[model samples]
Target: MIALLGCGVVLLSACGSMPVTGDIKAVDASQPGDSQVQVYAVAPRENATPDEVVDGFLESMTSDDPGFRTTRKYLTKEASRTWKPSAFTTVLSKAPNRSQRPVRDSDRSSTELTFTLTGDKVATVDAQNAYQPVAPTAFSRSLHLVRQNGSKEWRIDFVPDGLLLGQSDFKRLYRSVNKYYFATGPAADQSTLVADPVYVRNRTDPITGMDTVTQTVRSLVEGPTNWLRPVVDSRFPTGTVLRKGVTALAPDDRNVLKVPLNKKADGVGQRSCRMMASQVLYTVRDLTSARVEQVELQRSDGSSLCVLGSGQAEEFAPDGSSGAPDSQYFVDDEGHVQRIPGSNKGSGDPEPVAGPLGDGPVRMSTVGVARDEQLAAAVSQDSASLYVASVVSAGELPRPAVTSRAKKPEDRLSAPSWDGRGDLWVADRNPDDRRLLRLAGGTGEPSNVRVPDLGGARIEALRLSADGVRIALLLTEDGHTTLKIGRIERQGDPDTLQDVSVVELRKAAPQLADVTAMSWSGRSRLVVVGKEQGGVQQVRYVQVDGSAPASGVLPGANQVSSVAAADDEQLPLMADTEDDGIVKLSPGDNWQTVLKKGSSLVYPG
Candidate 1:
């Protein structure tokens, strides 16, 4: 048996108080945020793999499973550290690995390990859950511990399931650990080759008045290769799109064009330096390729192409067209990008597609999407599911950037939206016991008993109805956040989601503070929730077409938290009265109390 020490009292001079789970208490007990979070300490050893050290450190922090403890015969004293063992292994080195919840019903769900010491505090052993851990994610975990209290005692804590790699971390981690076949493209040694391609949506924006033909390619250098695919993206108009030739043989058999590089043109001097590969046998790369943010495709003849992969935006320009964004285009047969002259910076273009489907009501702010299904909030302050409207983008990451702000604590209109298939999505702070009850009128019904992500510590304002599925969640850390809207896929439960598409809000209106109260409005327009320099809550709209945000700031609504818009109808925010009463916003300057006094307002959906 390991000796229980009274060192905690000597080490921590502060008065006795319980530290929150997963919170890192200062070893020095200084003012908060002033000290570094000590994850682990190590005595330098020879020839140890980083993973080995990480594993050893994690092993020291967990409680051994009774089954494992029996298998090993007894506990080893060499693994001793400042803290006792945890309930599970932080690393993916053993059995009982972690698994995602069958479905994600809430806005945020995370899988983590907790380490408790003999004292009052606990440490988070979540380091091994890095986005791109070398090993596949694990579900099995064990805690190794010394006999505490002489009774083989173990305190039980809940690690919410359904945690997966964060989108940003997942992007990097997966890319780092997974070996990917380079999507090959035609190799260009030095000589330039040119080709032509057609029959696709032209790479241009009608809203910002940015046309493909009007652009030119100033130069061409091969960009990064994914799965062996050649790429190019030059922000200038000329560099915007590429002309990829298609050897499309069957129009009905397949929807996309794919063409093999003419290998017949070899030995042309320019041939050695310039190489080409098989494209979809066509000039147009589909929206799948456009999912990666900052990529644009063009075809030969500069006729048609795709801008954003999942039909999202690239840069959020005040005037629509992004300047100097990560751009991609196609090369011609001679390995030369033919469209020499392109966009003149943000000289202006048409509005980009704001989001999925068409104009709807302000209530559309509360929306969620699952491949074919959608659920939205009702303005009547009741929870209900609505049929989702289908929308498509030219980009690959199909999810949309919802809004920028989180709702104030427990704000209803700021609650979650529903994906079509099965999952219920809410803000980080969603009420744990929420349910999905379907609203009448739709042919189908919303999934009940759905699981949610609940990314934030508390649920705030949430709205999702039409335009596009939008989810706005607040994070407990520094109050920063992530807003999501777009397509989703389900795994098990009716409402559990497996994957989601990232709708580049850059494709939406390029305006900050356009979102008034909620983090996201709809996929089309996000309600600006942040107050500009002044404390006034201005209501702005993002068109989703890559132009400036709509100039619709409703003055006088200082405390506006959620705003919804119907087609051509006035957008309204959940206005509050001093008495807590809620009311629909009426025309006025900033700071007007739209609701009667003492009416603690709930989100009117």
Candidate 2:
């Protein structure tokens, strides 16, 4: 087990002894940024033999090329023309090994050679950009090589359809890039663009960053990544192509990118044209060292159709496009929903909200705020029932949304979560009936959510993304817990209640043996509280792609009952530190007590 940082003692009074002071503080906010510059190795010597060819090919597969074009040189003419590296990509946890023998020694002029490859498959990415989880599996492959026609030099005849790379090489060779896709929301902001992240080669050429922008634009025009296709839509017309005969792309001196699309974009709507331009701007802005203030969409003749400036881009709330809220909402000492005004400014005083749930007779054990922040869903004190209430004075009294029929108090309901579309989601913990229910907004019928491959695991906690497309779940089976992410699949008509299903369930934090709680820190990052196998409990940040970064311990707190973060990345992370009350932590900051008297705290995303 790894030793935790910031060791200290924090004492807690009996649960009811904490007080609710009406005082709040102001907190300073900051943002974090990053960059990736890659250096690729030179290609193998031209006169290399079969064995040398195989070695060089495998090594070059990990290079930062827009395509596996560099690795194709090791193959024969016909084989190279038939090869498709992007059909699938296998990511290995450790480096792969190839057989020492690349040819049959007995027959010097043998036309065929084979190289055996082996590795532990960690994950696989299909052409559609879907990441499928695989167990720690041992797999082997055989590559066929042959001497081309009359040439003594051996070239690969047949190879796998995908690219293979070690974990270290993946980190060094590729960079995560965000392509914008529109989120479905209310009519007022229905087509709001949200970021869908995908990994692309860090650079086309190691020297200049020119190819990065071109590669990104090509991927965006290819349509939303496969995993995000169902939940989001793109504005680029189908079959849109760059200007004829243009092999590369770069912004002009004015830092304005003029993207020439094919005739497919001929008669597009003005709003959609602007949105497409925004998608391009957001995609290439960070990739270029030049200040990109705007992206212009044009016809083949170079006539400008629309232009989107950096100032006009509308990013998702979770992307920190919208500033953090002035305060965070939590339950007061009386179990009433209250706000800590100016939470980003270090304000800690409690202020009751102007709503029925604020000071009403109803008391909740946990609460979830809608993405709009006007309504809240809460669990009753006993946890047997779920309730929805207005957080504004213009609303009505709290009403029971769903109640469990379980006789055992322990088998009640978990906390509720609100998606970007305002639907409330919760799981019934009753062992007799493990059901994930969705309560539609404004009197819509509740429906069961189909969870794929749930097996014998019980749902301990679940949180939805602001885009309403994915869910983070903590499941327990056989005394062990696992954290998994699944894509939400909605079928049928929206007017009539439809069945909601979860497909492509993949492990998010495969290293964590026990996950007690989790919350989305961003569209692609989740802050999880759990313990690794044989490790002590701790809090850490994990990417949806299953990358865990270093994290500090919660000072003075031994155990955390729950964890939460605002959808706005600028806000700090708040958690109910078990016996230590409520504490908050900002990036590069230590955990500090924000409320010395509250439990089940949360900052709705």
Model number with the top lDDT: 2
The deviation in Å at residue 220 for candidate 2 is 1.1
Clash count of each predicted structure: 195, 15
Name the TM-score of candidate 2. Answer: 0.82
Which candidate leads in TM-score? 2
Estimate every model's Cα lDDT from 0 to 1: 0.26, 0.70
List TM-scores for all candidates, in order: 0.28, 0.82
Q: Residue by residue across 1-605, what tens digits does model 2's lDDT show?
A: 01111231111111112224433222110011112423232344655666677766776675554355666777777888988877877877666787845454757447777888898887776675445556567878889887777667778888888888776666555566777777642221445566676666655633223366776787788788766677677788888867665445678898888888878887788888988888888777777778788889988678988887777775523344465343677777787787776544445677777777777777778888776677787787788878777776556665577888777766789888877666889999898898999887734556898987798888888898776778898889999878888887786766678778887777888777888888988667788888877988878877776654434244334588888876666678888876667888776677788787766666654
Cα lDDT, model 2, residue 282: 73
Cα displacement (Å) at residue 429, model 2 = 1.4
